[model samples]
Target: MKMTRFLATGVSVALVLAIPNIVTAKPEVQGQVDFFGGDGVLRSAEFDARIDNSGAAEGRMIFIDPSAAAESDPDGPGEAVAGAQGLLIDADFDCLVVTNNRAVMSGVIVDSNTPERIGRRILVTVEDNGRGRRSPPRRLTWGIYPNQARNWTPTDGELGFDPGAGTSWLASDAEREDDVPVPSNRSEAVSCDSFPPGSHTLVDIGRDDGNIRVRP
Candidate 1:
């Protein structure tokens, strides 16, 4: 009887340990963005995704917007961004879907109130069409306005704005209004005329302000 009871206890412990792996073995889908594009017709696709109560927290839905380099990938069923590496998706949150001439990006909405959230999002959005017309001709140009140019490192939910860190440029507006889209990652190649005037990497792209670097 004693041996039998010990054996049962061991089996129960083993089963409990295996439960987590079994639950996660299956990709618990939370949500998905579906669209259909074929031939020359570009139809607007409807987005759909849902959460599985049985799945773990890590099983949240993910919509990776690949960079322009691999937008039209002809691989088996897989997640990808237009030309970027990948993007993580989160439900119960508002997001921004930007459509430029070269790429399409669906940026997760971020409240600028938090600092770690800045660079938390990746900068996977890349334009294959030569980054548009060289900032055009203007007495005062805002290098990569709205979208952060470079040198901006986002952590947690806040961003490090550095004007002199990359090829991007920045301008100060006493009466600036609007929200800036944050990227999950940034590119290495920067344009000298892309950043604003400063040496800080932490900046609020939504507002015209100075840049500051964070101490890790």
Candidate 2:
């Protein structure tokens, strides 16, 4: 009887150890980002993300265009001409996560010619479908003009475009005037390769080139 009881206790302990830990957290998501410039240009990037149950997100954004011209004045021709200098951006970005599928990112732009200027800032907001699979981000906006100061501040006022001002690129005049939803039948699903290849540089996350990491 003593030996049988001991075996039963051992079996119970083994069963407890066999039970797996349940993870109630949301699964990680991966997608592409496309920024529409005021110059009628669209630049692409890659973003892999993990959002917590509370809707907070953490991710990395890798801009495609490493070297592009930085426009200081989007409307003024003289400052625009003078400010047309090659801005080499450091593509890898650690983002500031916002709840409800939004993020703000900033990175340094290396310009040997202009040593006084700082870097650039980008804002991305996407439509959320709770519990359903997340679609590709809808709005990827950036500063059309570069910041003169060392600290990064957005140039929304200088660019004459503000989403909060009801002048967003995604907002139509009717939607702005009436605050009504615009009729659309467009899918948000997009692949990184679907964007124009020449517009930006591409990063292969699978390679060991140190652009991205699974654990990091």
* Candidate with best TM-score: 2
Q: Residue by residue across 1-216, what tens digits does model 2's lDDT show?
A: 999999999999987776643444443434464444545454565655555567554555444543476555647765644543454233323333333443333333333243334344333323222232353223443432343343333456666665554332343576367774443422222222223323332222212112211211
Where model 2 places Cα greater than 4 Å from the true spot, the runs are: 1-30, 34-40, 48-60, 64-88, 91-95, 110-118, 127-137, 144-216
Question: lDDT per residue, candidate 1, 1-44, as tens digits?
Answer: 99999999999999999999766542111112222222332122
Candidate closest to the true structure, highest lDDT: 2
lDDT, candidate 1, at 148? 44
Q: Report clashes for each candidate as comma-separated counts.
A: 54, 1
lDDT of the candidates, in the order given: 0.29, 0.41
Q: How many backbone clashes does candidate 1 have?
A: 54
Model 1, residue 17: C-alpha shift (Å): 0.8
